[model samples]
Target: MAYRCPTCSPDIMQARETIILVPGLLCDDAVWEHQNAVLSRHYDVIVPQLTRQDSITAMAEYILEVAPERFSIAGHSMGARVALEVWRHAPARVARLALLDTGVHSASADELPKRQALLDISAGKGMTALADVWLPPMVAAGRLKIDIALRERLYAMVERMTPEIHRQQIAALLGRPDARPLLAQISCPVLIGVGSLDQWSPPEQHGVMAADIKHAHYDVFDDSGHMAPMEAPEAVTSALLKWMRDDRGLCK
Candidate 1:
């Protein structure tokens, strides 16, 4: 639990308190740089490098080792899986959670073939080829036509990781625990966001998660894909800020 400051309002402290941000697989600090810049003005934010670990449990444990005793957490994609595990291991330490373009179910047998195919392509054609197949579907419609720099940046972010990290992360994702049962047990605030065009993690998935969790907030960015934070930065950042300021336990 966060200790209230004598000089600070409970509301202010809750909104502007320490926060931990987790990046998606193969992504680093750059993934969250946009939100961090703005959130840091009021919130004490930390974006930990997540490439060192593979398993979600191990990754969450490492974060617990480095994070403050209690703070809010926001994560995207694979990082969001780690966030769920973090809450599972230490619910009292988490003040709130934000999951973006993510899912709570375990890796399905149906997904394995697709994932293996990606891995095979990565091993054969190269990481650039891997990006070509993956990145196109991650952005909003017409993004490639208008956002050359953003596309290049996303490619660069994925390119930075080695084949080893890719293999490790994929393995970790395939073995992640099913988090559906724990949703109702969450005592802290919850926020789930996804892009309407996000084929990987459709809005329906988030809607289901939100319905199960008490006072959970759900958002859908109509003009975005999987990368809503980058595709619709202003809207995403605005919603996040508002979620922090408004009722943390506002259900429905």
Candidate 2:
């Protein structure tokens, strides 16, 4: 069943296409807050809570379960990986795809111990300390230091998540498939983006993704970090709007 915003008029809802906004690890709908609010005006937008699923495939399945028969899907960080998995399972169902601040490769050799270190923090010090340690690196250094409201918002979002959730998501990421091969196979329009200062999943990574995907468009959110949706909402949302707008010729 298609989930229309409760506040939308029947005609408006019927005229719009559905779009799923997937949040990253330790992230909730708030990560896509600006996009969801703006896009809902012109499209039927659903921001699913990926907190329950432990694996990327499971998360993709959950999205497919609640999603409409056909829709555009956008995901950030770990959520972007889930989006690719969604297309992997149901290409015909995904009208378009946007991957923001994420990667398509499997986990690195040293990724586990590093991830475990954070999990250790979560287990020992609680989510706040985990947020303190984890969230700073996720944002641009300048923003983390200067954007008081942004830092607090990100911290609050992370603190809302449990250590178990963090553990599960890390496991999902570690076990994630090598998605590079899936790129050339993607038939729908694809948008690959990253923040210019994104240290974790840098713009260079997305550039490579753009090259592999046949119909991919690449973008970099200037002066932003890994959290582009939060740090550069306007640029991210604008790219999504253009990607979904058929008249803009992005699909061709």
Best by TM-score: 2
Model 2's number of clashes is: 0
Q: 61-153 in candidate 1: lDDT tens per residue?
A: 999999988678889888888999999998888878989999999988798999899888777877888888878887876787689989888
- Which tens-of-lDDT digit does each residue in 1-252 have in candidate 2? 334434456554434688999999999999999999889888899999987778999999999999988789999999999999999998888878999999999999999999999999999999999987888889898677899999889988998999989989998999999999999988777889999999999988899999998868899999899999999999999999898774222123
Off by over 4 Å in 2: 1-15, 247-252
Off by over 4 Å in 1: 1-16, 246-252
Error of 1 at 79 (Å): 1.1
Give the whole-model CA lDDT for all candidates, comma-separated: 0.83, 0.89
Please give the distance, in angstroms, between residue 24's alpha carbon in candidate 1 and its true position after superposition: 1.2
